[model samples]
Target: MKNVVIAQSGGPTSVINNSLRGAIETFLSSGKIGKIYGARMGILGVLNEELVDITAQDPKQIKLLERTPSAGVIGSCRYKIKSQEDLERIVEVFKAHNVGYFLYCGGEDSMDTANKVSLLARERGLEVICVGIPKTIDNDLGGKLQEDGTFAICDHDPGYGSVARNTAINVLEANEENKASYTSDPVLVIGVMGRKMGFITASARLADPRREMPLLIILPEALSQDDYKSNLEYITEKVNEVLKAHKRCIIVIGEGVNVGDLGILKDSFGHAQFSAAEKSAEQVLANYLNGLDRKDEKGRARSRLVVSGIARYEKPGTRQRREIAYVSEVDLREAYEVGAYAAKLALNGETGYMATIRRIPGEKYQVEYSKIPLNVVANSAREFPKKWISENKVDVTDDFVKWAMPLIGGPLPEFANFKEIMAPKLCRDYIPAGLREQGA
Candidate 1:
């Protein structure tokens, strides 16, 4: 029986722990596996020689992981492996612990690290099998786009479904608030997670598939930020147009949208930490909309409003990824299956591969779990298809909505609405005391 070691990396999603649970359940039942250990804080834990005995944990607690959100059970980290010594140290640790099977769960950088560790282990004469389990809310970990209007390698990532649902539901709830407060704050700018990709931001459309709401979505890829001033002006112009027509507008903007300098901080992988930034994309856009960024030659405010209200903003931050209440049924199930598949791969002596989800092309939404080379996914980042972006760039196409709808499991909860009934006027028109005293 060969001992197995599992580690989770990068930002966690609502269903990330289910992947851990899936792998553990698969490994425990396998007679070919020995001791099961979880590396604390991802690969850093392996380097620091801190491994938790997953096999010794309570069985009830193990089964409860299906509902557990995030990576708090074991832990996770953003520590990058930048040197050969680090890889060598990882192999040394595995050899010392008699760990013959290594299962890693993360996004692109983690996959790259797993690929490197697998090669080095073989070179060092260690009979170790390393497999990658895909986990990212960004939905950027996939191959090239196919002619059929779907991406290859991986269709969508495990964490993405839940985040997409979160974005959609948040937009739905925000719409009610915007409707109530539009008289004072005509524009509401919402910032959602998605480092550079537009997938999470695009999910806002799911709340209004009929396109009846006064909603605008801004993807980082949609706007050319070479000139930040023009970008802000363009967004301001678009918001005013919506304000002019609807008198109220809700804008869902990706955190990576380059409205202006956000003073962003980066993680160990050099990815921007938008939540930790001095400014946010929504804050910058709100300032532009409220006329704070634009001043007349006389130093007076040159407001961008087509209506009589200021623009407000809100950021969901990390909440978009780890909210247990917003977890998608399909996302949780697929996350578990992907982890189980990776474990099965190791049990079958498969190496240098990562488990992926590929959508079956049809009217009825379906997906199949398959394998792709770790090196392939490691070297590529899937871009939101250009065809999916609407021509105005303020919205996504129905094609995108159709493709992502099933992953969110099912339709969202419907809210109540009051009928617009007006009371009959029986008295003469009268002005309020303040207005009558000031003018009439």
Candidate 2:
């Protein structure tokens, strides 16, 4: 019996643990595998020879993983393998530990790492079967932008649906808060996690598909990078348009929007950590609207446009990806199945491949599991369809709504409201004593 090792890298999602559980359960039940180990803190754990014996854990706890959220169980890291010596050391450790099967769960960078390990093991005459499980909330994984405004290769990543649902629910809840507090805070700016991609930010539209809400979605792809002034002006213009019509506006902006310099930090993989930035996109936009730069003749900051109160900003940050309460039922199931499929591939001696989810082209929502060569998706980044960005540039098109609606699982919770019922007038309309001179 050959041993199996599983490691997770990069960020975690609400259903990421379900994928871990899926692989573990599959490997254990195969009967062909020996002790299973989880690399403590991803590839760094392998380099340091710190493998946790997962086989010794209680079956009940293992089963509970299906509901558990994030990568807290096995731990994860953003460490990138950039050296030849580190690659050799990983093979040496695997050989000494008798690790014959290696499964890596992460996004594009992790797939590249898995592909490298597979190739190195083969070159060293070691027969370790390596596989990758797709996991990323950004949904910027393998896929080609098709003319139909949909993606190919992999329809969506495991973590995206949950985060997307979280975004939709967040918008719904924020709408209620905005409706209640619009008198004091007429504009609400919400920052969602998405760097250079708008999948999560665009998901906000799912909350009000009828366009009843005064919401503006600011995608990073839709803004100008070289000109932050123009971007700010453009966003302010959009926000005022909504405020003019509805008296209250909600702006959902991507973290990577080119509003201004955020002084964002970078990870080992070279991706920007917008959450750790000195300032957030929403905060910047809010400050701009609140008159951070524009001033009156006396040098006093100008008030917000056509509104009584200032704009307030909120950043959901990592909660958008790891909140257990918002996990989509569809996403949870798919995460598990994709993981189990990867284990099955490894058991069948498949190498240099990653498990993938593909959508079936039909009216009914359906998907099939398959494998794609790791090299094909190793460093691939899917671009959100430009055609899907509405002509106004502040919203996503209906075509995108049709393509993404099913992935979020089921209908969101509906809130009730009382219809306007006015009583008989007590007296003729008259201006208030305080506002008579100013308004009447």
Candidate 3:
């Protein structure tokens, strides 16, 4: 009988803890395994010998983990095992604690870490079964586009659906707020989490599938900071057009959108630590647009739009990924099943594999638990399909909506609109002061 050690890495999600519960429960139910231990802060916890005996925890608390959000229970880390000394230290600690099964829950970089540990353990003569459990809101970990346009390997990540639900719901609610408040702030800019992938930002379309809302989505995949001036001008024009047509506009921008010269910090994995940046994409965009002259394409200045109330922005930051209230039932279930399946694989002496979810063909929203080689997933990334991106480059097509709709699970909240016809104005026609100044 071999003891199991599980650790979570990278950013936490609404359903990430549920995956932890799944693995823990599965291991406990299997009489073949010994005591189960959780690393306090990912690989750092193991390196520092900071192992918590999860088997000693109350069963009630374990069950409660199914609803718990984030990695608060056991905690998580961004620490990367790079040096040979760090690798050796991990093997030493596992051997000291008699840990023969290692389960890692995280994204692509975490998968690379697991693969290294598995290989290093064998080199050190330690018989360990290492498995990776997918958990990322970015949805950049694995999967390739098939000939039929469906994704192969892993369909979507566990945290992705929950965050997608969060993004969709946020947009839905923001539309209502913008509709009422557009007289003051005509543009609402929302910054979503997705380092280089647009999946999170694109999920905003799930809110208005009919394309009825006056919205613009800016993705890192669609624009780059290299041509900062050009991109900024193009985006400004789009926002102006929306405001003119609809009187209000909601813009969902990915955190990774190149806004130029943001002092960025890098994590151990060498990825840009967007959260630690001095300025966010939303702030930069809002500021830039606010300074722009409200002029028509013919170079005629307009006075109705003022710089003081041009745009208001919000960076949901971590809330986009960890908000339990927005968690999707589909995401929660898949997260748990992936973890449970990983544990089962480890118990069956399977090593160097990651538990994956494959969307069933002709699915009425069905998926099957499966496994893939850790090497295949390690250090690999999946891009948001170019075909799914609309030709205009500011929106996702119906194809993307079809692919993501099922993952969000239940029916969305319905918004109310009163189609009331207003009575004729009692006073003579009058022009607003600002518009009159512009000679309208």
Candidate 4:
């Protein structure tokens, strides 16, 4: 029987585990696989010999894995493998257990790791089929967009729809809150996730398709580290313009904006991670406004910044993404179908290919899950398109809205605002040797 090995990595999204569930269910229904194993905490688990056999898990429990939030189940790690020893270790593990089919679910870095492992396994005389399932709320993989030349493989990734919905809706809700507090608060600044991409911030446009609201959306891609002063001055002018027309305004900042200038922490991939960034853009923007001395219509000095941060990861620790009830049924189906297609690639003896979803050539919204060489994907990094942005950089063009509107699928998934839900957290708590020594 062909043994299946699957691993998840990178940031958690709402429907990430649904992809895992799809992989597990695909194997469960197949007679060709003997055991389905999950590498604990992504590829790091394999290097550490930590593998969980989901094949033996209860069918009901396996089903719940789809709706479960976070990498809390198999666990996840930020540990990266770059050395020769790392590659050798992965090859040995695959050979040891006959892990012929490997499915990797994560963002770019995870895809790179899976691609490398497939090659290493082949060198070790093991025929391993490796396929990648694309995911990320950032929606920054290589998907097709119009002639802007900057596009990702996904039209709107699984997690992006929910986040876009949340961002747009929150902008509207924050409008209500700010509207009520306008006497004390004139501006509302919100921080959103999207390390180097503008997709998340652009989603804010969905809230105001008519452009009647006095809103400004900021994306990291639209500014540079050195543009901090100019950016602030620019925003200040816009705020004044909005205030002239309306009593209150909403501003959205991408979390990674000016992170380099603010001294932020970076992951092993040299990508700026939100937790590592010393000060968030919200904090910086708020501080900028607070530090400045502005004047009202009567030239009265008013210096204050009303800002708050909304984390994308709240529980799986990625908020609202996997709030199962909040998950877009369309997104869940696409994510699951992506996993199932990855399984088919592995089963068909395809090696070193990333299973990517792409829209068909017609004018319709049809998509087909297919395979692309990981080498091509690993080499290219898709950024936010320039044409998608207006000259003012305050809003995304209508072309972007048309490209993104379909993925949100009309509206967000339904959920009770205060309803409490809990998944079974596994009980085997053990600290790492280094942490244990430090009494962590």
Output the better candidate (2/4) by TM-score.
2
**Clash statistics: count for each candidate:** 0, 0, 0, 16
lDDT of 3: 0.88
Q: For candidate 4, lDDT tens digit of each residue in 121-165?
A: 777778888888887788877745655322446555667776777
Which residue pairs overlap in candidate 3's backbone? Answer: none
Could you tell me every candidate's TM-score relative to the true structure? 0.96, 0.97, 0.94, 0.85
lDDT of 2 by residue, 1-440 (tens): 89999999999999999999899999988999999999999998999999999999999989998888888888999999999999999999999999999999999999999999999999999999999999999999978766544478789999999999999999999999999999779999999998999999899999999999999998999989899999998888888889889999999999999988999999998999998999999999998999968788898778656776789999987878888998899999999999999999999999999999988776778899999999999999999888889888899988778888898998998987777798989999987796556443
lDDT of 1 by residue, 1-440 (tens): 77999999999999998999889999988888889999999998899999999999999999999998989988999988999889889988998999999999999899998999998988888999999999999999997678775689899999999999999999999999999998788889999999889999999999999998999999988988578788888888888899879999999999998877899999988999998999999998888877875688887666687877688999888988999898999999999999999999999899999988888887887888889988888847889888889999899999999888998987898988888898999999998776555353
> Candidate 2, which ten residues in sequence have the lowest lDDT sum?
431-440
Q: List lDDT for all candidates, in order.
A: 0.91, 0.92, 0.88, 0.74
What's model 4's lDDT at 199? 90
Q: Identify the runs in model 2 with alpha carbons over 4 angstroms from their true place.
A: 147-150, 295-300, 431-440
lDDT of 1: 0.91
After the best TM-score superposition of candidate 4, give how far the Cα of residue 64 lies from its true spot, in angstroms.
1.6
Q: Model 3 over residues 1-440: C-alpha lDDT tens digits?
A: 78999999999999998899899999988888898999998888899999989999999999998888999888899987779999988998888888899999999889999999999988878999999999899999887777654677688999999999999999999999998988778889999989889999999999999999999998898975488777777788888788778877899998888878778899878998888999998988887777645667986544333322568899888888888988899999999999999999999999999999988767466789999899999989999998888877789989889889988879889988999789988998898888666455
What's the residue-level lDDT of 370 in candidate 3? 92
